[model samples]
Target: MKATLLSGIPLLIMTAIGIALIAQGKSADGRSTLAVGVIIAAVAGSSVIYQIGGWDLRRQSLAHFAIMLVTVLPALLLSGWFPLDSISGYFVVIAAFLAAGLVLWISFYLIFTKVVPRKADSSDAVRMP
Candidate 1:
């Protein structure tokens, strides 16, 4: 619950800013802003899968990436950010998404495994440091 709320803060802020932009006539299409908000929410919410217990890091990361792809790909298409009729355009989008996901996954893996200490298990209790 706490994690969900914390993740939602950015979504709310971005939505407010998008609304402001639309109201000020800075943004041409309100639909585009809406699509962006959806994309942001999807990306933020997908991280929750990574926090689930009992899953190995690889499984969790794959689940997170799949969720992001499923949500964000459609949002991107609906946003009209690229040529919808072009196959190459979709390939580009997919490629970019994969690249970005890889970077984020690696960073999170390093942070959790390297920077954060794990809970001491029974093996640790028996073994000398």
Candidate 2:
């Protein structure tokens, strides 16, 4: 809950700022900031899932990654915002998605499997020097 709030608050704030900026005629900057906020929110939300889902986090994360790859990127590309009709363009899109998913997975593995477990262990007793 705490991690979710911490992550979500920034997402909300940045999204608000993005809307405000767009209202003020700074559409480009506002859009970029809004995108950043969404990315941060997704990463933070993943952490919250780890906190809550226990054994199901991997499935959840992988599903989210796969959904984003199959739906989100194609939607963006077809929306005609970027030049993604060429072979190189498709390559760039795939590479970017894979890279993003890899980063997210690595972070999830390290935090949930490594750092969080260490913190939860009760065997951290101090030893005499």
Candidate 3:
């Protein structure tokens, strides 16, 4: 879809810039930039996905958020953000992260729908004989 493609361009560009900054040893700045970029991309871009993916904005947002979380979770865990010596501890940390992600996805999806709104379709036009 055009929306999906358009949404991705900014993400790719900003993420690439963030990665470049990280590579140049600006870790803290780069990390935050990357996060901000992701948030912006996910929040703004989700409207496109929401429209094209039908009215299932929650599902689409969750799917996208899950993909991003999968990419980032291992890094966070390995960096000691969530200690994982015991099995139960692992489950706890994972659950906490999942819960957080769910909250974020839902909040963003709701905000995107509210802020962006749906384009009025011609199909909605009143017709008379």
Candidate 4:
């Protein structure tokens, strides 16, 4: 639930921006922006996979990253945000995508590991004196 809400924030913001763009007469760009936002939100919402029991952190992270990469690559390519005519454009987009993924992964790791408290197991619960 929390993950979904957090993910929706980006979608909401992008929807507003996309609508604005459409109003300004850039319908294609606006629609593409909306599509990208939806894709991002889907990836972000996949964070719930971390909450599933039985999966190790590494497995969960890899699964999530794979989901992000597969979904986002197509979204970006279809959005026309990068040039499609040249090999260099493809390379540049891939590079930027990797850099962004690294930064996001690091930020999420720090936030979840350091900032967010772990779920309190019954054995670790505090008792009244």
Candidate 5:
């Protein structure tokens, strides 16, 4: 509960900042930064919630790595890191967001897995159902 609440703070702050920036004016650079920040906060927040819900660590780690790759890869590609320069800047940003979303989901999975583990019944019951 405490972890969840704490994680929410960063997300809330990012959301508020994004709203404020939008209200003032839709600056492209600002919007991009805001989007990234919001995404990060969401990932962190969701991770906490997953932990509170009880998940295993190994699985969670795999999930986290998957998500991070998904979220950051597109942006990196769009940034001209890749040989293919066909995609426009806007498209790059779009790809980045998609990746970020995937990353956040993975992050949540990881957090829950790491913090919450399965308990052993310590009993051998072989039944064919």
Candidate 6:
């Protein structure tokens, strides 16, 4: 669907940028970790607009907040506040990023499903007799 394609563009762009950043060694983690966050956040943010319609600013704002929370989870987890394992180095970093991304995706999906409206179509319109 056109809507689906449109929604996906930002996510794809984010993924490309994340990849570029990782390749340039600007991102904290390598390709996999940064990529997951960028792609997930993009898709999640876009999905809010896709489902709820961009006219509603509140929905869009919530989506942005959701994306932020999702992106931040991994960083929070890896701040050395909690010792989950004896593992260290790249493995720990990657795992933390992936875990955070997954959590964000799940939480956003749940919250958005409740708040975002269903896609509008011709059926929703009333005829002006």
TM-score of each: 0.68, 0.60, 0.47, 0.72, 0.41, 0.34
Cα error, candidate 2, residue 62 (Å)? 2.2
Residue-level lDDT of model 4, residues 1-129, one tens digit each, is 877796799899988998999999999889798877877687778878888899998899888878877778767776777887999988888888889888988998999899999899999999989
Worst 10 residues of 2 by lDDT: 72-81
Relative to the true structure, candidate 3 reaches a TM of: 0.47
Clashes of each: 0, 0, 0, 0, 10, 0
* Residue pairs in candidate 5 whose N, alpha carbon or C atoms collide under 3 angstroms: 55-112, 55-113, 55-116, 56-113, 57-113, 57-114, 60-110, 67-103, 71-99, 71-100
Single out the weakest 10-residue window by summed lDDT for candidate 6.
73-82
Off by over 4 Å in 4: 1-25
Query: Arrange candidates by TM-score, highest first: which order?
Result: 4, 1, 2, 3, 5, 6
Please provide, for model 5 over 1-129, each residue's C-alpha lDDT reduced to its tens digit, 9 standing for 90 to 100.
Answer: 664565567656766776677787855444555555544654564454335336566666566555545644443443333345455755765675568566865775577558777565547545579
Q: List model 2 lDDT by residue over 45-122, tens digit each.
A: 555444554557667676567656654455444433456667988777678767877886798689867788564345
lDDT of 6 by residue, 27-86 (tens): 654445545545455554455453564456566656654655565445445444445575
Model 1 agreement with the true structure over 1-129: per-residue lDDT tens digits? 754664587668767877887898867465577667777787777767767889987798778777777877777777767775879998987887778878977887799889999888877787668
TM-score of 2: 0.60
Q: Residue 55 CA error for candidate 6 (Å)?
A: 24
Off by over 4 Å in 1: 28-36, 79-85, 119-129
After superposition, the stretches of candidate 6 with alpha carbons farther than 4 Å from their true spots are 1-87
Q: Per-model C-alpha lDDT, please?
A: 0.75, 0.68, 0.66, 0.84, 0.56, 0.58
lDDT of 5 at 68: 48
lDDT at 56, model 4:
94
**Tens digits of per-residue lDDT for model 3 on 1-129?**
665666577778878988998899988667666765655565555455555646465576666666556544554454444557889878876787689777976786678678887777889978888
Model 4 scores a TM of: 0.72
Candidate 3 Cα outliers beyond 4 Å, as residue runs: 1-62, 114-116, 122-129
RMSD of 5: 9.6
Kindly report which residue pairs in candidate 3 clash with one another: none
